[model samples]
Target: MVAGILMSLRELRNIYELLFCDGVIVAKDDRRPQSQHPEVQGVTNLQVIQALRSLKSRGYVRESYVWRHHYWYLTDEGIHFLRQYLHLPTDIVPGSLRRVSKATARGRAPVAQSGPIPRPEGQTDRQQYRRIQRLSVDKLTGVELGSKPTPKPG
Candidate 1:
């Protein structure tokens, strides 16, 4: 249980940095579809953002922006707490993305490359719905849910 929590904390740390930085250093570069940022070895920027928001709500960081998008940046208290918990250097910058894994055969993460291609925005809601339904998972009782998930049909 402790191990799981620690792992989650690390994930939150990575995400907090990623979102606060706005995909500038950790997210994939738009021009080079072939190149990915070095911070998260296998995880996508979206996953990191989600984890950060989850941690934020629990007060591990600060407010979530509460999904408000009005403000970001770790509180002084939060930075202090996180520095101790994550054992980070005192001068750590806001936009840093630490690579947690080694490169793959293609020099990018195998897992990151495994997801389906992104759909164009012009796709209709019904088409998007069907695509999501096709990817839906069975509801499991022990799992926690994210707030304001991209809604799906019940």
Candidate 2:
């Protein structure tokens, strides 16, 4: 049950990332990874629906239906949560450097007063989601993710 929940959360996070980065969610007909629309590649239509439902239940996403298709967008609360989830601080008011510096001195990381977080090694959201999926599969199969398999002595 926990594994299933974790997988669902992973899917939810992927969906949130897609909306946050791409500003929209639409499952492509082709499920190939090399598709032009990387956002929907390798993501099933059912997975998209499930993720959207989870986000909607948490009030983080809103959906619109038109012509038998569903469109998804992040709510304000969703944007706030995404910022925090990405470790981009959103609470730094202007002219608060003194307090920020004090907090830093006390060992807390200084919050960025503005601007997006610096890109770290340029890893895309798709790559991150794939990594998470790999880890979850590894956990479920009792194999250590990112670890070398032990060799048997001949």
Candidate 3:
């Protein structure tokens, strides 16, 4: 599910880049030729419309009509989303696509050390197993097996 969402977001980002960079105006018709823009190269008109609709629902794109034809363009929110997606600072315009900053890069968060986790002193595997066994069995019966007194249930 997550992978699908990511793939869709990537496709949407590509479509946004094509529209913004190439000044391509997408129409409502699916019969139109695929985009020639490098970012959206080979992508069908239907796929582009779907991406646009998704973006529109997320407030990233807006639709306008001229005469009887519908056209799509990026909203301010859409531009902001694209900027953040590209890891470029909010202040920087996307016109210079090559320019990016390392501080705001969308890299993975820093992971903690990968060394073996330390166990509490005096609690070996055998002790831990016995503890778990006692809890699991005693809780169900309200008494520890082999014990003389019954535990009061709360």
lDDT of 1 by residue, 1-154 (tens): 1212233545556654554443222233232334433566545444444455554565545432333232334655556665675666877744424333556535786565666656878887689887676556324333334535456789
Each prediction's Cα lDDT score? Answer: 0.49, 0.62, 0.62
Q: What is the C-alpha RMSD of each candidate to the true structure, in Å?
A: 21.4, 20.8, 15.6
Please give the lDDT score at residue 134 for candidate 2: 89
For each candidate in turn, the TM-score is 0.31, 0.43, 0.43
Query: Which 10-residue window of candidate 3 scores lowest in summed lDDT?
Result: 1-10
- When summed lDDT is taken over every stretch of 10 residues in candidate 2, the lowest stretch is 92-101
Model 3: residues >4 Å from true position, as ranges? 1-11, 22-24, 31-39, 67-69, 94-154
Pairs of residues at least 3 apart in sequence or in different chains that clash in candidate 2: none
Name the regions of candidate 2 deviating beyond 4 angstroms: 1-11, 28-38, 89-154
